[model samples]
Target: MLAKSFALAALASAAFASPLVVPVSGGDTPPADQVTISGITTSGTGCPQGSVGQFLSADRETFTLIFDSYQAQIGPGTVPTDARKFCQINLNLHYPQGFQYSIMKTIFRGYASLQKGVSGTQQATYYFSGESAQCSTKSTFTGPVTKDYTVEDDLTVASTVWSPCGADLPHQYQVPDHA
Candidate 1:
């Protein structure tokens, strides 16, 4: 009886697997356009301890996305002229097509971190946007995707902020227009 129960459970789990193609409309071929995401930008500011020598470690900082891209970036694009407080980082693609790909996965992976310090704060914001076809509907995920971290002498604080800042694609399944 236990073996039979296990088989039923396995069969039920298999029924809820990810679908190959998300159905948008009832027709065989729904009106769709090819949307490609070339790249994403991760930018933010950091504040370090007051001491001149006490600096935040770039090695411990990160802004990553788990989408279909060629490479991810770590650390600031350019060294902050003022490293003590309010340092900024901007990373852009050198090549046009390096990180271009399609939007297959719904939940995109994102992460950011700042090392522990006497007193400091770090924030990473990722921006994602693009034009959508006239007949398509935009995604519910809206802008200013952000992650914030604070490092105090005693404790560390972190948070994940969501925004509608991602490649704008239409609904997976299409809907007919009303006259």
Candidate 2:
């Protein structure tokens, strides 16, 4: 019975394995005009202590979005000169020409400069939140197109923020419980 239960669980999990995709209804083709992408920065993995659940702020900082052809505004104002060294962006894209066949995956890079003297490389990803028909389409049986868009917020330090007191390392210790 235990063996049978384990097999059943495995089957159920496999049945639900699928990649994320956004389907465009009615038949439409990608626009000739460039797509504009924008998003707020979120801490990826190794974030400093005390900064979680907060959206990237424009205060004392500036944000911009750069794509293949154009650079657009993401946040208000300018990035501080000192903080520019630590910003980075990257992207992961999936495109399928037909319903079942995979076409390609592409990666793009972005850079930023800050007023506070901080600069860095970052990864940015794009998502197809919405699409508009700037022009009309002429075919229906063209092909099954699938696109999965996701932006990665991967920024690294361009320059280091100097602390008056050198690096402070942390030491972890365990104490015996009285209970």
Candidate 3:
């Protein structure tokens, strides 16, 4: 729910600079597994076909998404849909056997310029296809401000949804109804 939209920034940084490392409890070492992004798909008004540009680092540890037309706006003459936007990203990650993981946190980044009394919200739903459990996080911003913002939502261990240890089905981001 973005009352006044962002123009240039993205939901995530241009790329994640760090690699994902799986560790055992007590700081013990964990086995290594080859994790890769087999494919990705996007479907939403904010990320229609061909609107998103993707890039994966050579090491495959991180990726980047650039949006050409993802935005939102409000006030007179703006349609209802213009006030809200949804961009669902479904990532197909391949993990080795016995590899299990959960989304402990989610961070959203962007810039907004909202007038007084206007409020905007950003939401993300995480779920793997064929998995019953799902997790979501949301951030709300009250206006009378104009600045860049970074919001983080952490999912506790018990509240997080873990991926199937050795499942064949692909894990994807849960898209909202609007998408």
Candidate 4:
């Protein structure tokens, strides 16, 4: 099990990105048809070049990212870097007129294996490019286990921070390199 191997497409890039934000305004759902992902890019120690990428479904409501080398392991002989890895993914999206979005929730699914006394963590931070305000979520795994996992960050309506409209912004998800 790779603990925090950072690259995530099914590990949800746009899924994580879309999985990260949904457009809305005036209590109306943003036109799904008008919202489309324009671009996506990822970088991190958890995601070296070519180790991550994204795929969008035909209906445009869903997408997944596949990571080949994003994994973490810790034991004798394992390097320090094996214990944690992270990918920062940016999704540039076009929104409908007069509409903006908020990340109500995000689901991160992954494989994990841990020995007693150790723990794992996966985190995502959502923010618009060049903006100081942001929203973040985190999930933690304690050791003495090995299995698949799904971590969801569900934000309360009051707590949800929305993406501002009228500008081309890249929705960014990340675990800071030092974290």
Candidate 5:
């Protein structure tokens, strides 16, 4: 019995040592309708609505980190016709690091997609439960990085104006990139 217990412990330790690699792509990018903004202010289109760039391991090699929030925009003006019966998506990520937490809030806005027109701003909300850090430094990557993630939103479609005069997504709209 003691030997069996020891074996289980060893297996658990080995499993814990492994970092969770989320294979990302398709799902990370939010649909045209949903909006992705920041926490404090409704600034740029915060992170790729659903783009998972890398693993949020329990061990992070660096202090600062980057994360992407997922979202979707829909309707004739971008505002969900009905808030109560609108959309809801829950995003959860697991880093190899253990117990670190990040928060994501949705910034709903109205705009025209070259395809449709809608204009308004609303705040969508959700809660995510993800694992903590495991590495200290940021993982290095070449070319466009990709990873997989999950999202939950009310699966309802809203009508939108076929033509928008001036439609645009939320962008940092900053002046210039510092060298």
Candidate 6:
């Protein structure tokens, strides 16, 4: 009898411990209506000249960014073993109006594609959970609750020998402009 009682208590605790999961529309590539492109900035050696694109959901609930393509180096020396091409991406959530909340945790769902010395692709899906924080007196409430994350795994063309190279052959994130 005692064992059965303990089992019931454990089950109750487990149920309460589970967090509430919020459902979002965009899985990886957010639908057109669910995103807005604010601005994009690109800087790097691999693809120094690049562009930025963004998507903000119509309701302002979700935000996503794509940092085109940037040039990067994968190996050593001016003539690296591989000249990697990559890009950066970000997907996050925004607080709904009149609602107060704090993010307790964030989950990233996606895949990474690495092409030996060339271009690659990266996909990201973000899930967030938090406690409610009443938004009453606050005059201004803006921006995402979490950090602006980046994923640079895409490479364009691979080179067995680094023919065209530069001093800055590393990966770096550019500050995106707001739309």
Best by TM-score: 4
Candidate 1 to native Cα RMSD, angstroms: 21.0
Worst 10 residues of 3 by lDDT: 15-24
> lDDT values of the candidates?
0.20, 0.20, 0.61, 0.65, 0.21, 0.24
Runs in model 1 lying further than 4 Å from the true structure: 1-36, 41-80, 84-117, 126-179
TM-score of 5: 0.20
Give the per-residue lDDT digits (tens) of candidate 3, residues 23-88. Answer: 323353234337676776787877789987887777665566666766666776677787667777
TM-score versus the correct structure, for each prediction: 0.18, 0.16, 0.77, 0.80, 0.20, 0.24
- From the highest lDDT down, the ranking of the candidates is 4, 3, 6, 5, 1, 2
Q: Give the TM-score of candidate 6.
A: 0.24
Candidate 4: regions farther than 4 A off: 1-10, 13-15, 19-27, 176-179
Clashing pairs in 4: 2-72, 9-12, 9-65, 10-65, 12-16, 14-18, 15-19
The sequence of per-residue lDDT tens digits that candidate 5 reaches over residues 49-98 is: 34323322333311112223323333334443221112222322223211
lDDT-best of 2 and 5: 5
Alpha-carbon lDDT of model 3: 0.61
Off by over 4 Å in 5: 1-85, 104-109, 112-121, 129-179
110: Cα error in model 3, Å: 1.2
lDDT of 6 at 130: 30
Residue lDDT tens for model 4, 87-141: 8878777776567665566666667666677666676787777888877777776
Clashing pairs in 1: 24-173, 24-174, 128-165, 128-166, 142-163, 142-164, 142-165, 143-163, 143-164, 143-165
Residue 128 in model 3: lDDT? 70
List candidate 6 segments past 4 Å from native: 1-50, 75-179
Query: Is 3 or 4 the stronger prediction by TM-score?
Result: 4
lDDT of 6 by residue, 5-111 (tens): 00000000111111111223323433434332233233433223535344444544333433333222232242432333333222222222222222222222222
RMSD of each: 21.0, 25.7, 4.2, 3.9, 23.7, 22.7
Best by lDDT: 4
Of 5 and 6, the candidate ranking higher by TM-score = 6
